[model samples]
Target: MAFTESSLLLPSVSGTNKNKNKVPEDKWYLAYIVYFTLGLGYLLPWNAFITAVDYFSFLYPDASVDRIFAVVYMIVGLVGISLIILYSHKSDAYVRINVGLALFVVSLLVVPLLDAFYIKGRVGFYSGFYVTAGAVGLSGVADALVQGSIVGSAGELPDRYMQAVIAGTAASGVLVSALRIFTKAVYPQDASGLQKSANLYFSVSIVIVFLCMVFYNMVHKLPVMKYYKELKVEAVTANEDNGPLTGPVWRSTVWNIVRRIRWYGFGIVLIYVVTLAIFPGYITEDVHSQILKDWYPILLIAGYNVFDLVGKCLTAVYLLQNAKVAIGGCIARLLFFPLFLGCLHGPKFFRTEIPVTILTCLLGLTNGYLTSALMILIPKIVMLQHAETAGIVSVLFLVFGLAAGSVIAWFWVI
Candidate 1:
């Protein structure tokens, strides 16, 4: 079925002569920037919100309230994300991507408004979790749809786009650190004031998301060639081949890809999940503890983002030069060891900040490379004929990993 789809999508075979020129280099760069900025808007301020929420908890002590909020947020996010995947699979790629970006912008705007106008003083520990999950889920769905559309039109997807997205996430982390510093400087004496300042950052993030959305739409419109049209036609036909869409059409397609891909990548994802789960509190708690006084976590996050961006950008070059999937997989797997060890033993074995910092940097660098490799590997393994199916499969894998990690963290605490 995928073969049939790929044949239809490919210009050589599909015989559809729409736009033959290559995607302009400038447009490609702009697309990356838009993607990166969008990512930053979604993730950066959210990280700050997470930190602020933790700080609020200390200001207004209530364990039961916090737990209740957390559970509810997680449940809603899980359901929302599942729906998003289903929607993306069923809807046109263009609509899904555009709507997803709009949703993200809306969430960014709403959260800040809620913080500034209504919610005050640690409304719940899980408030950030709930809000962020919704924002990110919307963002993810949009991303899947947009990428699928690009693949459908172009017969190929840019491997670097994924890295750009992560890079934006890393950049946002750094920005959060800067904001934390400003918050500390301005509101040294009052925790409530600092929380209000955090709200300001969220508001600013909304503007960023809106701008990126506009930029992406504008760029998408200017006379660009068709690269993925054959891919799209192939996907439509493949769905037809599989029989009428019924219950869990997206899930069925995704699972089939997972079964086809080499188990090694799945293993790597599992290891990453386990490592992240074991150290669930580190990101929000340890980073907060270690850096809050000086806004150190923001610095570490920034460094992580810079390296992550570099790693992602370079992935295409690496694959082109090396062209070895297993080697890339192995490299990504090896990087996890230090992360796992750092989480497990960083506190006990390395009391000082230096060792922990080194460990953290290594984790970011390796993971950046690994993530890039993983993104590239997916299209190759799944076959271009089933690009849409592959995209759905890739996102589902990420969603499951995220969901599992969140659940495991909760379970461990319980």
Candidate 2:
């Protein structure tokens, strides 16, 4: 069914004028802020687990804590997202997001509860490591349920909401980095200090996840949200009347949507492949500085996170709006490979803290802007009825990138 601009502008209802129910206002931008908060909240659990890597490493001395976390989380998330894409038509976004939010609370609670009651600042507890990894996997599953739904839901709305969601993801990183820095400054560097910092991360994440649950439920009650959702329902109903969306028909429709957005998907995959190959793994494990000592990685991570937030927010002011240029920019990000490699094997100056830090910030900046561009562009390319599926499909491609990038991180970094 061809969904034209006029159809979306004036969806058929029982008895309403074409221009009677114009799109409702967001009213102080509450819906945008809620979406922003939802985006931030979903990633916070993953960040909490990753940001407390030092403590986890200290506890599980035998394991490659960072690499293992990345692999397990990304793989699990990839699988979960694939399943979400397959069964999206059978379910709904509202239920999926609520369930995912609850799961986030459960997964986040695991670490601190275990530490407080059982682990108790002890060492040589491989079992604890395994349990923690399981928690990470749970968070990954939660992320799949929540991230795709949030992005897909936003896809059905105006472009600004999508920008808010993408920017919120970057903000999550900045928030975690700030928490890491605060904990480092306040707590002593001993075991007690590490445990305290780790606990703080989980506690803060739990609070935010709960807030997201509240705000998310509150948002649907808003008039602006009702307006968009009503239009979506009308569009879907119109499409269904043409014929029942049988399995094969739906699959073919999904494939068509994929074909249209394949270039965007490729760019997203390449972006993460280059980024994950060099980041956190390289910054945290490979590099070292005599002056900054333990603080070097933290500073580098903070710089990257701050710049990422800047890049994501920039789209709000001036979106590129051109897919060709955005994809080319993603291709250009590959240069980071050589630049970062130089930090390891190039001249003395390239190996210094300054060059490495700048490259890392650039990596984040590019990652943020390019990802937001592709995501915002995907839904616009598809019909209204398929926009949600398109959003989920895009996220599935993104998870593939994350999974591949995580695996490569182990081998790509020196």
Candidate 3:
């Protein structure tokens, strides 16, 4: 059997091979604008968490603020997945995309407000959890919307949109990390004080996103709604071919795909969870201890972001274009088993902080390539059928990854 299920399902092999080249050159610019604007909104509050904790710890000395934030993030992710399934099934592409963008911008704006007012002066671990979780939970609404738009437009747009997303994430991570470093250097006291200054910074980010939303609405001349209409048509066509099935039958089919794909997605997710688990310990114990207090997190984050950016960019431009599903699957499987062993043995050999940090960075760099590869493979695995099911599978894999990391952390500590 051929590696790909069918050539007809493979999105255009080359940019020039697209069916309807209706995407205007101007639309490409709009896409970049969307990328940069939303990128800033997503990252600013995220990076701000580091600074916020510095301030919040002053009031609540015993709380593990980062852990609190992480737990809340997990919950928000679950809710977000639910929203994606519901909205993607019912809503048109344009409404879903626009509403998603709006919600995301609103979430960014709400973060500062929550911290500055409601959680201000509170002195407990859960305070950070509540504020961060509430902000991220709201943001999940936006994420679902964006993903719905992506699935709806999958075959319609160039691969550049996916590229832009990865690039934007990398850029945001780097830029926000740099900004935290700069703010610490110049306004050292303010960075650690009431967080009023950081609140101001996030407020500026919200404004930029709002402006971008307005611009996107104005310049989006293509019939974005029509994309979802077409998706519905495709679904109907598939149903007709397969013959009408009961709800239970459809459920069974989706579950079968989920089970088959779990190992593939889980492999990638495990790598990430291990990296995330190792990172905080290494940064706090090794990196911060060795380096200047202010420079440690910034440098590590900057390096991680740079490597991730390079990996994703290279994959998008080269690997994904020539991707064969079998090759992609083999690489994922090969890398995953070693990576898992590395995570298991790493703490034993690289017992020191510095060595562990290096290991973490390598893990990050390798995982970046794997992540980009996985995203590309996802569409091919499911083809156009049951895309929403595929998306749900991806999210569940990530959640499991987090859980696995958390469990490993407990064992390592013991």
Candidate 4:
């Protein structure tokens, strides 16, 4: 799996021996960019929706629609990925990713279109609700396809590529956070301005996802990428000892993978559970300020995203060097729950924006570092043949954590 030596690298299926010598050692950076961009596209829609809580609250008027949307998105992502795993056992990662991204482009467009109509008094709340729910749910399906495929695909490559995809995910959060902050500040503080800005935000997301499809399709053409895919296929197929395990979509195959990597899976779950339980929703629904009441949630979401990106990227420099240390950091994020509560009900100073912002930043930082370390380390811990399955399973754990955390987010209101 450690593809460091020159002798180990080979020409692609159609490539020649001379082409192998021609490939610049650094060309793999292009592949990394492709993986990162896909990762960014996979999560940008969710970030856009989450960061725009004020618009949803204004539209629905009293219903906790944002929380409901977040929970529904997570649940649907889990179900969608499960179906992909159990049913659609296609080896063509490109087709799966493209179809999902195309769906993302179309679904994101539907939101602003419907919002425009609703603003003109031609549509009702239920119309907007159904549209938003359907759009968010559609994005969740795209997330499963893109995320699971990219991670699982990258998992089979060198670990650094997998880290690249995770880095792209963190970058998406940061991108959307910056976009939201700028848009909110520039747009007028009215319903019309909100609608205009929201449409612009989603429009930009559609463009990025579209470019993601274009770039990913191009990435497959790279000789280095083709070599990795072939290498993975040979690894799984060439092993004569793996008789029944050769069946990719079998229940037993999935079970065996889970059984072998239970600790890594559980660590991934705890990482997301602690982070999501209080993010977006807690920062959206709870906490307050007189001066920044309207802008507070948006800015806090930005803070979390910025720190999360910083944390995830930090792994490239100084990973904790131990799996347990990484898991410990994730569990430590649970401390955020009580700390956030203190912000809500403990000391008056704790409830202020400054202290809450500091805690939120720390939460994001720990979450980013621990989750990245565990994901980067997990596949390497398992047999190389099961690396792809391990990546998909890691995604399953992430959705489980998101589902659980979104459910917990509601308890603050209940």
Pick the lDDT winner.
Answer: 2
> Cα deviation in Å at residue 209, candidate 1?
1.3
By TM-score, the best candidate is: 2
Q: What order do candidates take by lDDT, descending?
A: 2, 4, 3, 1
Candidate 1 lDDT: 0.53
lDDT of each: 0.53, 0.88, 0.55, 0.75
Lowest lDDT 10-residue stretch of candidate 3 = 1-10
lDDT by residue (171-262, candidate 1, tens digit) is 77667656666776777546677667756676666677677667766755544323444344555565576676556765686567658754
Regions more than 4 Å wrong, model 3 = 1-47, 91-97, 114-133, 140-158, 190-194, 215-220, 223-246, 288-294, 320-360
Q: RMSD of model 3, in Å?
A: 5.5
Better of 1 and 2 by TM-score: 2
Angstrom error of the Cα, residue 219, model 3: value is: 7.0
Cα lDDT tens digits, model 4, 1-414, are 233322232223333344444433437489878888888888888877765655776677756777678777888899977876664344556777788898888778877777665655232476677778888888898888888878877777766677788888989988887877787788886777766667767887888899998998898788777766665665555553556543543677778777877877787888777777788768877777898978888888889988988988887776665766766766677777788888998888998888999999998888888888778776665555667667788888888887887677666552
Q: How high is each candidate's TM-score?
A: 0.72, 0.94, 0.73, 0.88
**Root-mean-square deviation of every model:** 5.6, 2.7, 5.5, 3.9
